[model samples]
Target chain A: MSKLRPTNRSILRRLALFAGLTCFVAIVMFPFYWQLVTSISPPGQLTQLTLIPDLNNASTDAYFFIFRERNFGRYLYNSFGVASLSTLFGISIASFSAYAIARMSFPGKALLLGLVLSIAMFPQIAIISPIFLFMRDMGLRNTWLGLIIPYMTFSLPLSMWYLTAFFKTIPDSLEDAARIDGCTPIQAFSKVIFPLALPGVFTAAILTFIYAWNEYLFALTINTQDAARTMPVGITMFQGEYTLPWVETSAAVVSVTVPLAIVVLIFQQRIISGATAGAVKE
Target chain B: MEIRKTDGSRLRKGLSERQTAYALILPAMLVIFAVAVFPLLQTFYISLFDLRLNHPTRNARHFVHKLNLEQYVDMTDRGRSALASLSDSDVSDDVLRRLPAIGETLDRLHDTLVSNPDRLDQYERVRDLVVTFEPVRESSLRYFRISGLEANEALSLAEQLQDDVARAIAATRESPSRQLRVLEQISQDVGRSIVYPNFIGLGHYAAHFADTRLWSSLINTMTFVGFAVLFELVFGMLIALLINRKFLGRGAIRATVLIPWSIPAAVSALIWRYMYDGQFGIVARALDAVGLIGDSSVMLSTGSGAMVSLIVADIWKTTPFMALLLLGGLQTIDGTLYESARVDGARSYQQFFRITLPLLKNTMMVAIIFRSLDTFKVFDLVYVLTAGGPANATETLSVFAYRLMFRQMNFGSGSAVAVVVFICITLLSVVYVKALDSDMLTGHK
Candidate 1:
């Protein structure tokens, strides 16, 4: 009877906890929900204070304007192309380098690791002008290559640095066993090591893609032409030279942001784990 | 069987050797070298040339030359003498017609004066000499000689001298105290000039050290970063504590809390900017309803208002990040610590201060430093929200650099600003990296 009393009290405490957590969660998620609601609400009803819009007033006209009037689809393609290419190139180069750092006893290994990590801390703006001049000299200004090259500079450092840490976590014994079983070094890496480190690779890919996609200054500086501009840059075009069209701008914002939100929700666990793993591992 | 055994042994040796590591690392190193190191060196190289694309061929060799005010004055004196002699000469039409060589000499002299502004006083002296000849020709034409060949030649020479003197005066008038300022302005006009110039032994550092704007921005950045990080940490800790408890739909709550962090910073900042819009924004209306200010109040139009807006926007976006980090830290703390504290009759506040805080010190530092460094580099929020407006109240070092590089097109000064920011962030990173190396958060010895 006494144990039952404490158990019942605990259940009540848990119920109170649920209510508090629900409130906090609502506060946390309200902005995104608001974004979605505002994005879809009729132009007339957008200013309404209510959480839920009148279904009769809701329409996808804003989205239509964003696509038909703004050409947001092209910006999406540019962002996708730049981010995907950078991720692919950054990861492949980082993996091979990470593999060497993790497995082989190389001369100046510490120095190489130090250099890669140090470059990660450098502000991109410091080198922006020189890079701009270099690209112009090479006839790469306002081209995809202009944005991609600098994105690689920023992405490769962190990718190589983090990938190296992840590579170190995987046991070398597995690679050694593969080698003894008549696998070449490259074969052992691809067949055994690469598969084992897919989580790290995914983490690196996600981080690289997000970094490249979210970048603003470099993208703005390097890609001035509409053909090369990404979503963030394209969003600025919605705001004319002086006046901003809030309704249309919000529509563009929602379209560009929704895809990223979907990505985050789907990969929440991996992101959470990956973000904390290196920091926690010391 | 013998061939296979030999091949296996060779492969093992190759795998274990340093050569394989070099092979793997070489490509990345080459890319880094090509992309990062090469450009930096090239920028330095470009800085040494008097290479303005607008005026490409002027003083190309002496781009590395540094002249003092005295040397400039001497050069200007020589130019003045040459101009004076040419003005005073008596030559026939044919002789005067062959003076294109003298014209070329005058052009070179003008280039020297324009390129080197430390000689401005000397340029002013030359200008004075030419101006003296200007009225003499006009007076002589009006009174003595009207339309003769001799009169035309004298008037033409006087006009040419007058134009050259005026150009020299204009160049000198545009000179700034520091060589770097002149170089930066020149670089902007000539887009192909080096992005970051290293003028060795320049006193720009001293000048910047004395500048009040630098200190003010630094103090503002520190205050903003400190408040934002501290408040976010506190709010985040509370939220983490709430979420850590066993609750209904905990997974959903966790995901919801992460929503703010998931939104891109630029998008969130833009959203917040609209939310704080003075005319129709919900916040403006809410504030007005409470009589916080007039209905016509511009929340971002004043310095304090802009700062407050930035802090609020930052807290909203970053509290979730802090919560996520703290939650990870919270998970590592054993529940037994709380149980033990309760058993010892310690109050909740006591338990928190003694047990929770002490245990979370390193995690707190890690989170604080990371957030602090990030906030110090605050750009998108300030850029979108206020753009260092209302009399440059919100201009952080990063914004200052942006204005210099992009708006002003002064890459040299912009690079200097960037270097300063880099130093500040590097200092913070060093502390964090040290904390990371010591396994402070993991509680490892």
Candidate 2:
């Protein structure tokens, strides 16, 4: 009976906790809400500072304005193309390297781990000058391959870290069983282990996609051509003709963010796990 | 090269484990090398010389002195034809007397330019490219490296010819101003046609060491990283603690909070810049309404205000990520321990200090190390939002390096800045490894 009806003190405590959590979340998410409100409003009433815009007056005219005026579709294609290619290449490359590091007891394993670790910590600016020059000389400055190569390289460290740890957690008994059945290590990895590690590879895919999608420095440097810019560079250098640029920028942000926000919403747990890969112990 | 062991259980002969492992990682190592290691070495190598792409003579990295043969040939060839016309009967005797000496100097310079057999060969090819214009592309073929003594001899001859031209110019003051100007310009062009070797060993580093901009940017980087990490940790802990408990809207709260971190940094900068806008931003108006500032414009205008505003945005953008990390750490804590502490009548704060804080140290170390290095290399946020603006109070090392390397096209100094950033991050990593744990290298908790 007492458990069914909590005490006033406990009720108040729960209410206070809920209220605090709600307030903090609202504060954190208010920027996105504001961006939405600003993006939905027509250019005439954009600066009205209304929490709830007059629904009858609000219009998503700016979305059409961005696509029409700016070559936003090109940027969208470039971002998606570059990000997907890099993620695909990054996953395959990182998986092989990570499997060797995790499963095999071999010489030079520690040195290889150290090499990849430092490459992970290697700052992008340290190599930007030479890369820009090299890409320009190679006639790859405005191409997708140029961006994909660097993106793939930088994404290797994180994917390798996550996949190595994930592979280590899988029992060795499974591989031994497969080997006893006369399967090679590669055959076992593909036939038996690879299917089980799909969750980890999926997590790495999401993270690396996000990385290549959000990468600004390389994209800004290499792909300065109007048609080759990614979403980040496009929105940063956004210029709208009729609608205000800020609103169009907000619309661009909204368009790209909606797809990603859905991914984050659906995979928040996996994303968190992937993010805190090496930071937390099981 | 298959070797079958006599007593092996498996019958088929294939690659050894060591060879297979090496083969597996060979592609990744090559990619990393091509992208990261090779470029890093190239940048460091380029930093040793004064490489300026915009300047005509100093564009390429040269080891020895060279003459800009295209411009030198064009100027002298045109001067010879134009000066020959000035030797008509109407020209003054004083100028006429000096004319042969100038012509003789030009002939001597031509001989000296192609004097050595080696230079003569290289210069003839370049002269063919310049002189034959239709077949060969002259753009890529320029700047032959010449000997020091030849360079000195050619430069002295050019100087003597310029002095003779000046004397002739003074004697022929009756000539048209345009003719005098053309004569003066030819002499100047002839004098300005030598490319000096721009080999400044360690000079960029030494000069940057004394530069206040470098030191102040370092200080700014430290200040930004310190405060951002500190606030993110505190707020991240609070949020982590709050969300760790059983709640109805926990999923919604977690997902909603992650939206900021999921948003691109450049986009986050855009949202914050809008929210911190003086006239139309709701946050600005609310801050003004609360008397937090004299006006809304003050947030983005003043240096401290801009820093504080950006810091607040950074905290908002990244605190969720930090919280998510701490929450991962928090979940790994055995719940029964907390329950035992509660049964022992220990208060929540005491339980936190004794149990959670001590247990969360490793996670904190890893999180802080990653975040600090990342924030130290912060470019997109500062680059898009403030752009080291108002007075450069917000300039970090990455931003400074970018401005020098990309915007100013000063690759040498910019690379020095980049190397400084790399060193500082390395120093920080060394400190963390020494102070935190050796497990960092192993990527083990």
Candidate 3:
């Protein structure tokens, strides 16, 4: 009975905890909210220091401007095309290698794992100059392939790490059982293991997509022409010499962010798992 | 190749499972090599050469000092015109006397350079093609081999003659037309046309090691990484702890917090940039209203303010990610351990220190290592926000290298900077790896 009603001390502690947690949540959510408000608010009223977004003056002018005035649509297509292709290539390539690492007792396995992880840690700037020159020499610059190739290379490690962990979790007994049931190794993997590892595959897909989507430095350097520029590059270029035109930039920002925001929302748990799957133990 | 066992009459051989496994991984290995390792090796190679795309003559890799034939031809033509016109012009007695002497010297140098008729023909052909904006196919015909000393002597002599002509023109006290200035400029430019071999192996690296800008940028990078990761770790831990408990709206809180992490970094930068704007920024206004800052503009205007602003935004942006990782770590911790600690009369703080921290060490190490590396190579944030600006206070090594490589088009120096960044990053990774491994070993012990 006494446990039913909390004492003042316990109540105070709970209140304090709730207050702190709320503050954290608020801090995390506020900047995004501010961006939305600024993006929607009338250009003239963007400077107004209103605590709440003035709904009355809200307009989709900036969004319209991005789609109409700029070649942002082209940037959008390029970003999506490159990111999707990279994700496809990255997953297909990594899955095979990840499975081999998981199932096969291979020589130099540790070294191979170490190499992939080290590649993940490589600073992009270190190779930017060389890649720029090489890409130009190969006539790959300002093309979707140029961006996709590097993106796949970098994103491969993450997908491999996730898939390897997932594949390792599936018991070896399942494959042995499938073999006993007259299934070839390939048939067993495709029929049994692949279906089970779908979640891991999805995780890799989401993470890789986001990476190629968000990638700026490589995209900025490798693609100089307007048609080949990604969303990040396009939005950055929008901040031209004369004026920033914050409203249009914000609208472009929203366009780039909304699709990612939707993916995160829909797959928040999987995204979280994928992200922390790297740092945390299985 | 087929192998036969002595016990077996013959061994039917095809690709082994191990070979298939190797085959599966081969594509990934090759891709990594082509995209990552090959570029890194190429960067190292390029760093050894003196390659600048901007300079006309010294643009390509030069192993030996050579006179650029294209430049030599253009300068000879221009010099001939300048000298020939100078003799016809009304000038001082000193100018009249020096004009003929300078012209003769120019002719002598021209004659000496073109003494080989074959080389002269190649030079004239290349010159004609260059003047017509046609690409010269043969590099050998474009640059003539010349000793460094000879090139230097000719350059100095030409410069001295130019100076004398300028003085002679000034002595007349007549208004110098644009034509005269153009003539003087052409004369001055001819000396620079001599391309000296700029291949200085390990020279940029040597110079950069002592370079103040490099050191300062390194310091800035370290400071930013240290503070940003530290803040993220602490805040992340706190959030992780708070969210780890059973709560209503837990899913909502989890998803809401991750929005920042999900947003593109460049977009987040833009958002924060808007919020940190000196004018019309709600954050700046609010901070000023609360008297935390003397003025709103100080946030983005000053170096320390901009740094603080960036740190705050970064903490906000990444703490969720850190929290998510820590939360995953937290989930791995057994609840029964806490119950046992409580039964043994341990307080919550004592229980946390004893139970949570030691176990959480590995996760923390992993988080810190990854975050530190990411922050160390920070470019998009600093770039989109302050652009290493108000005077380069926030300029990290990556940004510095990017500026050098792209904006300035100094590939040789920029490649050196890139190499330095890679070395520093490798060192940082090694430190973390060693620390993590040692901690694990000690934990096991």
Candidate 4:
């Protein structure tokens, strides 16, 4: 009762908590603020000591420069191509595996699950050079196929994990009822179960696409040609071509990341849950 | 009972179900194998051999001592023509005498290579293929094995003869001609024909045992992961606890937390890089104002400073994910447990230590394991930020391997370093599984 009272001690504790939370929030949000500030600041004002840009003078010149000069539009197009294709491939393959894991009584199910989890954690560096070599030999290097296959491969484990958990929640009785009504197992899955699993599939697709979009090392190594490079690799390489042009670099960074930020904001709950799907379930 | 007379239709249905399950999983399994398993195995295999693309002689893995026929044939033909012209050269007698000795050395080389009729035939076949502008079909046939001793002997003899001829030609300064100089160049080409075997099994890995660079990079990697993850775990848990409460705008706060994570790592690196810029970075100026660091430039300029800057950047980027994970763990803890503790007159801190911390262990372990592995393989952040620069001080294992393999084009050494990274990752995985064996076994469901 004494501690619960609004005594000086309790007031100090409340102030401490608020201070901690404010610092945490500020630190978490400052980078985006800085990114935005740098993006809008006039090229001449980039080296200004102030953290915030002068609103009246802030210009979109850097953005126009990114599009007109750096060819970031092409990078965006390539990134979208790789990300969406990989997501489609990842979701499709993961659907069946998730279906089997969720519905079937397969031998080695545990082993398969363990293997998928391990693959999710496989370091990309370990296989990067080999993938480069193999792709070159197969004449796939610098092609979209080169980046998509590895992206799909790495995306499978996470997609499968998310989808399997989702599929488990759907009742088997619906599929069985469809079977009894004269639908084939595949038909039963497609008509009855597949519709029910949309949310999970969407989550997996979004996550996979984000993974493919944001993946750097594979995209960097696999696509040496400028025409084939993805956004992350493209933008990183932009830094090399332009010598520390913070305004233009920030413009490019904001353009690539703003869409993601907006999407995450709009779908905050879904994205958060999906991202923490593994840990939450455990 | 009547064996249930397994209904024919039902039996067929069951068989079809099993088949469908197999059919469903087949594509995913194939993709995983082709893209993940095969390359990993290939990496391991390649690391066992010396496969440097830069070296003319040992550019590829050689299972046995091999002489390059394309090289040998070209050299021998050039040598013979040079000798033919040199015998009639208007150079001094000393130079003319030297031509025969070079011819003798060339002859000896030809005899050693041609001693094995099978090889000589292959060599002749390769020469005809080359002359006809036909490509060699097999890498193996393109270079045939010679006795290591014989190859060494031929190499030295050709080299010596080349030097001798060049000296004699140079001595005939009065009769110096472009033809004599071309002869000197041809002999040098002949000297470079021997290709050594490149099978260095476990040699690359063996070399790392004493490799200081490898050790330093490994240490850097471990230090980065250890400090970053530890701080992330603590601060992440605190943030999770702070935000896990039912507060207004908590959803907005949660989304705000995810922003750093949603942004591409390369983008995050760029932002941090500018923010930490010595002259203009707001963060650098702020830190300097607060006296946390001596100056902003020192942030990315010094070894320890670069490492610190990187760790701070990593912590900033990843701690939110940690918080999200821990929040997931926090949610699973029953609200009633805290109410019951309150009724029993336990303080909040007491309840936290006894209840929340214990319940959050599994999720924490999983989070830490995942984050540690991620931090260990950190390449891009270090790459785009400090570039492991200011004297190789911040070079993590992955960046080190990238430089070796892609930059230096030393695939053999790079692959070897990659394998070392694989071993480190495996060790981390084993530790995680061992620590959370029962948790992992039960968590999948």
Q: What DockQ does every candidate get? A: 0.45, 0.57, 0.54, 0.59
**Candidate 3 C-alpha lDDT tens digits along A127-245:** 99888887898899999999999999999889999999999999988887886687765787789899999888999999999899889999989999998999888888888785677
Docking class of 4: medium
Candidate 4 chain B weakest lDDT stretch, 10 residues:
B1-10
What fraction of the reference interface contacts is present in each model, in order? 0.48, 0.73, 0.72, 0.72
Which lDDT tens digits does candidate 1 get at residues A1-282? 335756877778777777767677676666566666777777665456466677786777888988887768888899889988888888888899988887777679889877786676666655676787677778998777788887876787767767888888888788878877888778989999899899889998888888888888777777888877888777776777866677777787777767777787778777676655544443
Clashes by residue pair, model 2? none
Q: Give the residue spans of candidate 3 off by over 4 A.
A: A1-14, A173-193, A240-243, B1-15, B70-111, B114-133, B138-141, B153-193
TM-score of 1: 0.77
Tell me model 4's lDDT, rounded to 2 decimals: 0.84
Candidate with best DockQ: 4
User: What are the runs in model 2 whose C-alpha is more than 4 Å off?
Assistant: A1-4, A239-244, B1-15, B68-101, B134-141, B163-186, B191-193, B438-445
Native-structure RMSD, model 2 = 3.5
Model 3 scores a TM of: 0.88
Scored against the true structure, residue B272 in model 2 reaches a CA lDDT of: 89
lDDT of 3 by residue, B1-445 (tens): 1234653423212235567678879889999999899999878877877778786765678878777777767766776776777668776666567666566667666665666877678778878987787776677877787777777677777776687657656655567644456567767777766777778899888888887988888888888888999999998999999999887889988998888887777778888888888787888888999999999998889989888888888888899999988988998899999999999999999988999998898888899988999899898988888888778888889999999889988888889999998998899999988998898889889
* lDDT (Cα, tens digit) per residue for candidate 2, span A1-106: 2457798878998898988887897898788888898888876675674897777878888899889988888899999999999999999999999999998767
Q: For each candidate, C-alpha RMSD in Å?
A: 11.2, 3.5, 4.1, 3.2
lDDT (Cα, tens digit) per residue for candidate 4, span B1-445: 0122458956776677778888888998899888888888888888888887777876777777768888788767876776787787666777776677777777888887767879878988999987787888787778777888888888887787678777767678586676667667877777567777778899988887777999999999999999999999999999999988765678888888898888788878988998888877888888888999988788888899889999999999999999999998898889999999999999989998999998888888889888998799899898888888889999999999999898988888899899889889989899888888877677566
Judge the docking of candidate 1 as incorrect, acceptable, medium or high: acceptable
- Cα shift from native, residue B177, model 1 (Å): 41
Report the CAPRI category for model 3: medium
- Model 2: per-residue Cα lDDT over B5-27, one tens digit each: 57462232333676778888999
TM-score of chain A of 2: 0.95
